[model samples]
Target: MTRLDAVVVGAGPNGLSAAITLARAGLRVQVLESHAQVGGGLSSATLTLPGFVHDYGSAIHPLAAASPAFRTWPLHAFGLDWVQPDAPVVHPLDGGRSVTLERDLYATADGLGADGPAWIRLMKPLLDDWEGLLDDILRPLPRVPGHLLTLARFGIRGLPPADLLGRTLFRTPEARALWAGLAAHSILPLSTPGTSAMTLVLALLAHAVGWPFPRGGAQSLADALRAYLEFLGGEVITGVSVRDARDLPDARVVLVDSSPRVLLDILGERAPTAYREALTSYRYGPGIQKFDYALDGPVPWADSRVGRAATVHVGGTLEEVTASEAHLDSAVSDRPYVLTAQHSLFDPTRAPAGKHTFWAYAHVPGGSAVDVRPQVEAQLERFAPGFRDRVLACTVTTAPQLQAFSPVFHGGDVNGGRGDLWGLLSRPVPTATPYRTPVRSVYLCSSATPPGGGIHGMSGHHAALAALKDLFGVRRGE
Candidate 1:
């Protein structure tokens, strides 16, 4: 029986995005989610203690602030408010000395001393048309961008390896280390080709719009999206996993907010052999060993700025950061690079009064069950003395556990898939619209698509538009 016009098989940000789009276009949309709650990566819970709340998947949301798709939605009106820290990021060195990426471009430069001029010159052009620049970079490639020169200039800088660019452009260790920390977000080694693109865009995001988190945890953002969909007469069913398209209610179109692996399973024999092989051959990157801490007091950081920064890069200098990434590339290292966010420092709702919540993760070899907490804690303790003593309680989520929780984080590859040089452009498969799969009415709408990962929701938004234009003949606006 035809129960809905469309069915979204995952209620992650991407799934909800596609559901909302179709609902707004006057189609009956129903989202079926495996998890009990909505937000796929946006869910937050009291992981450590009764008072402490930690994000299960993503923590900081720089991409959300600049997403063209989110810009069109009135999510803020639906009770999604952002809370910003004093600074976007803090990179601490050996001693108490630290470098901060401030919200204001000039303020961030001021901390760089002599390299301030070079920083200003490098960032000025990008900041001028920040939104336009994001528009060009934050979507499927192969299409003509509105701003050709802006994208070309970005390509010139972003195309280079971050290691080379940092060494060539900046003289100081602080500048180079900051870039390394930012580029490490790519999950690729700093020496890799597209690594510079990750660093440039992340730094620009910090200087353009401060890295912020949703108030009352990321669930608020997901709830807001779900609420907006409901207002548009859409619905979602929880705890229902769609193992195959045949298992789902009859619908005109089905958008899967899942990884290529899950898509392969769902399609089964219905999938074309080439598409099945392509999805099967789709590469997943290194996994993550995550930790959440409930602290008795603020982390005793050597640098006071670390208290103000919502996100902290715990690895030491440029050379050290590069070495740590290389270690992840080959094997787990004792001194691993750690990406941390202490939102409870800025957002009070994350925990009870006095207690604080801290989220951190280190990249580990794919499908590795090894617990990297000791090393992660060691790294934190390296920068923040007395860090181990301050923890009231701690919770660890192994790579296997992450994959078990969400299939999209297959093998604990959180950013969807491997984002190497080719991983960025030809993610999953290279097509004008990466959303379309062999099954015409069935579209893949996950971070596995172009503009991979983080809480941007563009992959879902783009997939929905593609389905509308091609399948339903309805342009996104209409």
Candidate 2:
């Protein structure tokens, strides 16, 4: 093959984004992926039976829809249609009661009982500056922020521990539990600082962008992105794993959209001593065991609204969620807090006629082999009775399985690395420039970079921009 201007290792959203960005810069760019198909985490398959499409990783996409980078590309033209539900999220309590995170702020707050006003008061500022806040926080932070006031407001009120936020702002268990469940997405302990930021960002997005996913499966979104990249003259090579630096093309610029450790492994001796030590010592949070269920019918949720919403948090009260998520020392909970999404309810293409698709995941110790299915079933049956009887088929993915499937998923720490207190600001290693590695003309564009996890792909976009300005002559605005 001819030498390319840029070679992006890994074809996840971040890799695709880097390749696409470089391609848009009028450079010859090639993306190499290990799997036959692209879209590392975004890929989907019929893990159960034919005709049932399930998302392999990301089920709900609020960050992707609102991303500054994705907004520039019209992915919808390439068969990416987002199906938004009536409510973005719903947290179920006992006795047929559930709280929905409606598109309208008041509508969501209204269900919080006595803490309804407090919920609104806490979220209103972030919602008011939703776009600005995302623009600042979506990428690396502590830079000269454009919206310093908005960032300041969010940081002051949103940086507390999940347990603290829940207890202080919410008078009712329902409201507090909802916050706890959303914050648990961080995979950090509830007592961990900066955990509350997840709740604030996710909650605001429910109203700001409306939590939605592609109609067919998450893979459809990836396909659309890849198609867009190809349209821009970028090339993607599949089934080619780049383990050593010798596997990469002789390119002017190289971007690795993998974990920091994987980048170190691929480049090895090429990376300097300091950078090598930093990446090797990188910390990861608890792993997640994801379950995809092909259901005979919709989940028989006690509260019908739980099925109506796109995502559901199945953990009980705030205290209960805290106890379940405190598995930092690598313990799995029998009554683990679980997040579930019944995609077929909103997007029928996910399953066959009358049949349904259920996606759920629970936190466990990194690389644990214990089966969390019984716990998952118990959680589902806790809110939705007789849930097991409706299952036509199910597939379980442990941390090791996810890691084997995609190297970037390091120990199934899906956020690339932990986004806890210290790890949040200084992920992949403490440096003002997270994307720029020790090696010149090489960058880390994966979630291991700044802004940590999610499907936003901003890390790739930013990394490509850095490569363009620092290596090439091209540049973009601040």
Candidate 3:
């Protein structure tokens, strides 16, 4: 057999990306996955009923669409087609009203009424040079940023708590509610310092590249990535688990796309005490209890405009959304904030004709086993009256179940680890190169590394570049 140059463990987006990077550098590479399929969070399945395709993890792909690494690749040629909705997001309010984040910046701002100018003033500068902003933010921090001025501008606005920024920037309830919903994606409290960072990114991506998903399902994106990897001469082997160093193939370097704890287990005694301690101390944020529904018909949303967007923020008002996320550690709220996506509305392939699929989830305490279906459905019914009547089938996935499916989602924290200020800076361990471990030939390439979470695959891309430069003396563009 030909000698392998690199081995990437776990066939998540990161793993596949690492393999593709190595193979592109003219090195032989292989990927191992425990699951039968790739796309750790990007995978889809028939969770509810036949012909109803529900995304197991992420439902929307604003980040994936705008990812610098992904944009440069030919995923489109390998069956990756984006399904963009008329609007990127719709935040429903009381009294049958809704606000939308449109693909056109002015349209979205115009809908905000009194807060229109504030909205443009806040986003226009960053949106103007979004490509440069993404390039600097999507990698490790504390380095010489390619766009120093842009990074500095983002930091000044993003360092404040989302709640503070939302109140201080926008006066209207519509704008404040929209900002709160976007900030809540962090899975951290809206009041948490640095929560505004993700809020800004998500909103910017809406205008930069309307929130989209693959034409068929998120799995199509993964399948396309795998196909592209094969085209690059890299191989992927599923149903293979790499538990420890002994299980890894003979290769010059290994990139791990699992959690920090899993990485420690793989390293065993080879990792020094200090490094092991750092990995052990890594903290995870709140988990989520997700729901997938096979509906008999479209959700009868109170405001008809809500149907225009695939992504819906179901929690009302800034105060309501803030309270819902604020008490995650104590108890699940009776009216919890729900992040919902109605994919069948835009993609016919998601369900049988006239039928629809609903993907929604609410943040719960870490490793929570409690079922929050009642609360989730109540939120849905609150916004979309008669919504319960349309449900053909429902599949509930608890937080623990999510962790069981993939170790990367440790304690069901989808972003991998906490995304707070400290969490982002010291992810796994504070270092110039978080992907590089104490072992020279081994590296960590999961969301546990820099640019934590979301499906961009920059974690894997940066890790592969590191290994390429160190092990093969191959830098990017070589």
Candidate 4:
């Protein structure tokens, strides 16, 4: 029975970030994870064929590189290289046409036709003040940062991605459809407020820092964090799942990198009645089905622009994406809004010299066990003719399997809990300290908390700060 100052359950990015922070603050910490490996959804592997590595979960890092916490940590000093591709994303339209968002804002604007000026106007201010804006949006909620004024100015009277792009800069169908493609990254309905924000933020990031992936793979990002934690004298225990409070070790602090339901189940009667009830009432948005393929070569898109991007959004039009999302809103699976990332283009190490690896997935009704590989492949085939021939082999992970790997991704809700306005506010619950829980000295640091879902790891960093302040009389190291 080894006692430690803190025990973080789950060794995902958030969990590792928390443990590393705590250890740097001179505390003894131990992390426990149910999976045999660390990194959770960010893990990488050679699944289908030898020498062809696949990102088991997330592939790109627009937010991770943009994270203040990640920047301050100096992960690059630990051999983690952030690889940037030529273009962040490419949206292929109905014809043999495509829209590409380059790292240069002016170049991207020039490609949008009549709406070009509006595109520049909307993004210029945000891009210029990105650091200040990010400080507000990514800061721990309930504590407004000094940049709140700037943040609110940008957020208020906002147009959603579809409408914003449609009315302002893009009269052309291709241009509007292009912005809609970026907006679909949120997986939210087209008209939603935060949906537009997500699109703009990602677009701004494309110009500011560009979307980057690790040189070795995304797993390298996780491995680097884990290494830092252990270097600071923290430890991780893999294959150990905590189902109840008794299953955990006694410590001055405990942070769960899991969903609300998992926390409720672990605490049982120990949790406050209200908190438990709120956990049960938690609303998870529609889920998704993911596919990882070992490809023989690049996807044969008619428009060569598709080959330049790290990722591609495969929904047809703004109205089509909205209609499909609306169907999912009503518990319909929708034809799977395909989000595909081709890492092989940038990292030749991901596959054989001439071959490539493909990662793709689509949204479905929550808890639906439908295998959507056929539908997704057919959709890809529409853009890239003979796409079926590119596949040497593939593996499809249903929603349940995804959930099994990361219970936090409940019902395969990839955006963590939910991204909608209501779900974003009340999810896991509304509280002054959203990360703190009923049990003393315990916290929730997973994406289920504020700054919901991404590889950013801010939730973990925030939760650790709270634990430091509450349990150990410390703050964020002035």
Candidate 5:
């Protein structure tokens, strides 16, 4: 048998991304995935009914579309097509009113009414350098930023808690609600510091590149990535789980794109005691109870304008969203902030003719098994009247189920680990290069690394770069 240059465990976005990076550097790389297919979270299935394709994980991918590494790759040539809706987001309120984050900065500002000027003032500067800003933030921190001025400008506004920032900047119910909806994506209490970072980036991405998804489903994006990797001479072997070192092919380096726990298990005693302890002490935030609905028709939203965008934030006022996220450990709220994506509305490939699909989930306590279906449906019904009537079938994925699906979604905290201030800084343990494990030639490239979660794939991109430099003495752009 011949020695391989690198072996990547897990065929998720990050894993495939790592393999692609190494293979691009002219290394022989192979990816191993436990699932029959690639895309750990970027997968799709007929969970509810036949002909109704549903996304098991991410639906709308603003980050993936705008990723630095992804932009450089020719994913579109490999069967990836983006479906950009008219608007990026729509946040519905009571009284059949809603505010939209339109693709155009001026148009979105106009929709915010009196808060229009404030909205422009807050977002325009960041949007001007969205690409530079994304490059700086989508990697490990505590390093020299590529865009110093842009990062500093963002830090001023994004350092505060979302609750405080939203209330302070926007006065109108519509604008504040829109800001709250964006911030709630963090899956953290609106009062948490650094919560505004994702909020700013999401809003910026909305204007820079409309929040888009693959035309067929999330799996198409994954397939395109895998296809591109194979084009670079990388091999992907699915249905193979790497439990320990012996499970991996003999390689000069191995990058584990699973959770920190999974990495530790694979390394066993090869990992230093201190490193093991750090990973063990790593914390996870709230999990989510996901609901996928194979609907008979489009969601009958009260305002009707909600159909303009594929993504909808269905939780009323800023106060409501803040409360919903704040009470993660307690009883579920009747008006929980439900992040929903209706891909079938724009992409006919997602559902059978005339029918549609609804993807949604609400934050919950980590590892929670409580059935919050009634509460989740109630929230849906509140904004979109007769929502229950359109449900042909519903598939509820509990927090534990998400963890089982992908260990990176540990306890269903889909952002991989947590996104709080400390969680972001000390992800899987604070280090100059979190991707580098103590064991030589082994690295952690999962979302548990810096710039945690989302489908951006920067974690894997950065990790592979680290390995390329350390093992092959290959640097970026070298």
Candidate 6:
């Protein structure tokens, strides 16, 4: 009977973050992962081919660089390396013209021409207050103290009449396209309220700290975190799936980094009726299908700007992106919006010499079994005419296949659950403490909680603090 002060049953970024926090706080912590390895989305492997290590889910780490949690964690000293590419992203328009966002704000703004000043004005404030803004964005609804001030700044500058920010940001079509390109990262419709805020935050960080990838791969990040946890006397057990509380060792607290469905399926009657209803009533967002490609060389884009960027937003203009997103939710889009990342340009170690590794994915209806490769390739070719010829080998994961990989992605809803305004508010479920469940010591610390999705590990860290203080009377700084 190996009892522990805390046990986190999921070794994803959130789980490991939670475990590390608890262990550092003088608690005997242990992390249990269902998979053979850690870093749920951050895991890396030779998926496409040998000598080419591809990220399992997320590749880029803009949030990691900007996150207060990461800044305090000092992960770099633990063997993590950050690499910033020359260009952040390239958005291709018609007439063989494209816009590229670079590490310098002035450079990106200049590329947009007429909308240049507008881009700078809209992003400068948020960039200046990146840390303050992140605190408000990452915390739960009621816990955020500066929501009013933050919302006012965003509304006054970022939002437009009828309270829409995405559309009213830029007057020029190309500028609007650039804004849309940034906003699409949220995986929500451009009309949404928080969508614009998400856009400004990510864009600001792009220039503030720039998007960084670990030296080897995202797995290096996971491995570093895991190693630190062990250094503090914490333990990690992999390939051990917990279906019920009985499967876990006795502990003062238990945090689950999995989805509500996984918890409900196992805990069943043990879960309070109210929480279960909330989880059951939860609406999932659009599904996702992604392609991991191993190429002999980079994706040759007609516009030279495309080659300079590490990322490429494939959807055309504001209207085009909105229409495609709308069509995706409705399950029919001849031209879907796609997000592509060319990791090879930043880190040559991802592939063999003169070779590259590419990742692209599109949103679709939930539980959709669509192949999505043709649509994905077509969208890529829209920006890069001869993109198909660059493919050496590829692996396509359908929505169901992705869900099978990580049940946390229920129905392939990568944002954990629906990311709409209502969904964001009621994420996983609406509660004062979304991380705390009715199952006594058990808590939900995955992206399913407040500040849903993205690489930020606040959800786990916040949940751990609550569990420690509430469950074990372990006060911070005591």
**TM-score on alpha carbons, each prediction:** 0.98, 0.98, 0.99, 0.96, 0.99, 0.95
Report the Cα lDDT for residue 19, model 3: 86
**Model 5 alpha-carbon drift over 4 Å, by segment:** none
Task: Residues 103-198, candidate 4: write the lDDT tens digits.
Answer: 999998888867778778778877888877876776666775667666775675243445554546567776777777777777677676667777
lDDT of 2 by residue, 1-478 (tens): 7878999999999999989899988999999998888899988889898999988998899999999998779898988898999888899999999877788989888877788899888888888888988999986765788888889988887789989978988888788888888888888889988888888899889989899988888998899989999999999999998988888889998899988878997778988898788888998877889999999999999988787787999899889889988865578777898988889998888898999999999988887868889988998899999999998989999999999988788888899888886887788877777888888888999998878899998999988988998998898863
Candidate 5, 59-99: lDDT as tens digits: 99999999988988999999999999989999999989899
Scored by lDDT, model 4 comes in at 0.82
lDDT of 2: 0.87
- What tens-digit string does per-residue lDDT give for candidate 1 at 438-461? 887889999999888888888888
Q: How many clashing pairs per prediction, in order?
A: 0, 0, 0, 1, 0, 0
Question: Between the candidate structures 2 and 3, which one is better when assessed by lDDT?
Answer: 3
Model 4: per-residue Cα lDDT at residue 119: 79
Better of 4 and 6 by TM-score: 4
TM-score between candidate 2 and the true structure? 0.98
Q: Write the per-residue lDDT of candidate 6 for residues 141-172, one digit (tens) a residue.
A: 77635646665676465433211565566778
Could you tell me the TM-score of candidate 3? 0.99
Q: Evaluate residue 168 in candidate 2 and report its C-alpha lDDT on the 0 to 100 scale.
A: 89
Show model 4 residue runs off by greater than 4 Å. Answer: 157-169, 330-335
Alpha-carbon error at 374 in model 1, in Å?
1.3
Clashing residue pairs, backbone N/CA/C < 3 A, model 2: none
Query: What's the residue-level lDDT of 127 in candidate 1?
Result: 86
lDDT agreement with native, every candidate: 0.87, 0.87, 0.91, 0.82, 0.92, 0.81
Order the candidate numbers by lDDT, best to worst: 5, 3, 2, 1, 4, 6
